[model samples]
Target: MESESSSESSLEKSMENVLHLQNSDNPGLILVIAPLNGTNYLPWSRAMKIALCAKDKIGFVTGEIKKPSKNSPMFKKWRRVDSTFWESNGPLLYNIKREISLFTQGNMPLMVYFTKLKKLWDEVQCLRPFLVCTCGNCTCGASKAIADFDEDEKLIQFLMGLGDHYDHVRNQMLLIDPLPSASKAYSMALRVEKKKDV
Candidate 1:
């Protein structure tokens, strides 16, 4: 009985390290991934692997990680994904990891994914040294587990009356996405591009 309880405790601790429930005085860094929706997971998961393998200074925080899993009881304390992930995606969720299928290369998926993500995080990485950038190996870290830009989209759109935060920036954006061709994905702001005139 004691061994069984001990084993559970060990598992809980390991999960806690992989997915923090809240910010600590020194929470290291946050790697915010998108929600576990079909459209968001692939790119976000790729971003997660790169961040995890690339840096010890940062960690991941995702809405999907909070959902229930086989060992749901272990993460009973992780019910808060907002305070935990610096943004909320509703109640705790988990197990979606099993549901995730590795995204393969076609048109060089990595090539395409990086292009979009880098365009988004490039500036953020360099400008905010203390941000996700500079804190990780690529010398740019932080965007690892950012709230799904899509999820944030709804909140931002719904709260349009709350005075815009990203609109000025978003409005100026002409739909050009950034690529992570370097193979190393670091968390940074974004690298916007001027739209090519048709």
Candidate 2:
């Protein structure tokens, strides 16, 4: 009986150690030394793993520590630490935006340049998607308006990245009453390129 009781006490102590939070451990605590910029993913991840291991929290990320029931005492703390490790959208979004802003159609063919820009734009759209109304009774044109605005923004960015050789085409495209979608703009530029080649 005494042996069984001692084993039970040891198990409880182990559980307590797993769930224990040091005074410095909090949601706001920065775990790794370097924040994860868009680059340096491997090194950042390695450092983060090391830091989490040091804190006895690596299981939160490695899936060794499954989430307990909502009523369990460890639930909130687990959630807080887990969220901090996974919440990386802000840096990713910033990197995408920066890439879009810096993009330019240097010596590359129009098709290649447009394809690259389109990929970056698609990433941005996926990360920060527009909200669409799903209710059958919706009357406000807000969703369509938002979509149009997003397309227009993409069209402008596409045109802005074109070389000076495309100045006339870009200006003509801008003069349209409603801006063309980015794909339509790309098609227009492509036609111009074919003519120039001829």
Candidate 3:
């Protein structure tokens, strides 16, 4: 087993490689935050890929790295975690290297979140996204509220703070809330709002 420091270092290196890959333009970034193992991750990721590719003028690419098939000896070096992938919705400026399952481990110390936040903050500075979208609160139930007692609150705060800080600094930030595809909750909220408007 790799030490925590080494694991984090490796994760950052992988992200840099992905981000540095060639792309026609830099559409800035759309940072999606959700549980590493949650059921909604894959769908939300794919949907975001498609939406960005379809509508955004910038170009991007997406790829997945899961367990290598037994027949392919080249994949022997791939990480044993779940299928890690990135997809280009259409064309975008930057390639998204997902930071999945990296910080969600059990018994992690507080510094872990800070470290992740700093890394993401640096990414925002580097990518200079015109927009930063988070798919965070959409799948969350009332049970997942950001109260002080909740262990996940630290992560949640960091994710939210990333967008806020980016906006404050650049003054060009546009956050696309809970993409409409993730949950029925968004539809339900819209229904209530529509009823009120009528």
Please report, in order, the local distance difference test score of every candidate based on alpha carbons: 0.38, 0.82, 0.38
What are the per-residue Cα lDDT tens digits for candidate 3 across 39-156? 3445655665665455331233323433346775424334321112233332221332244223332343324545554454344333333322245554644433432223343334
From the highest TM-score down, the ranking of the candidates is: 2, 1, 3
Best by TM-score: 2
Most lDDT-accurate candidate: 2
Tens-place lDDT per residue, model 1, 86-183, is 43323222222212112222343333544543333332322222334445564442464342442343223222221233345444332324322222
- 1 or 3, greater by TM-score: 1
Could you give candidate 2's per-residue lDDT for residues 65-181 as a string of tens digits? Answer: 887789977678667656655565777998889999999999999989998898787667655645777765556777788889989999999999999999999999999988899
Candidate 1: regions farther than 4 A off = 21-45, 52-77, 81-198
Lowest lDDT block of 10, candidate 2 = 79-88
Residue 140 displacement (Å), model 2: 0.7
Native RMSD of candidate 1 (Å)? 17.9
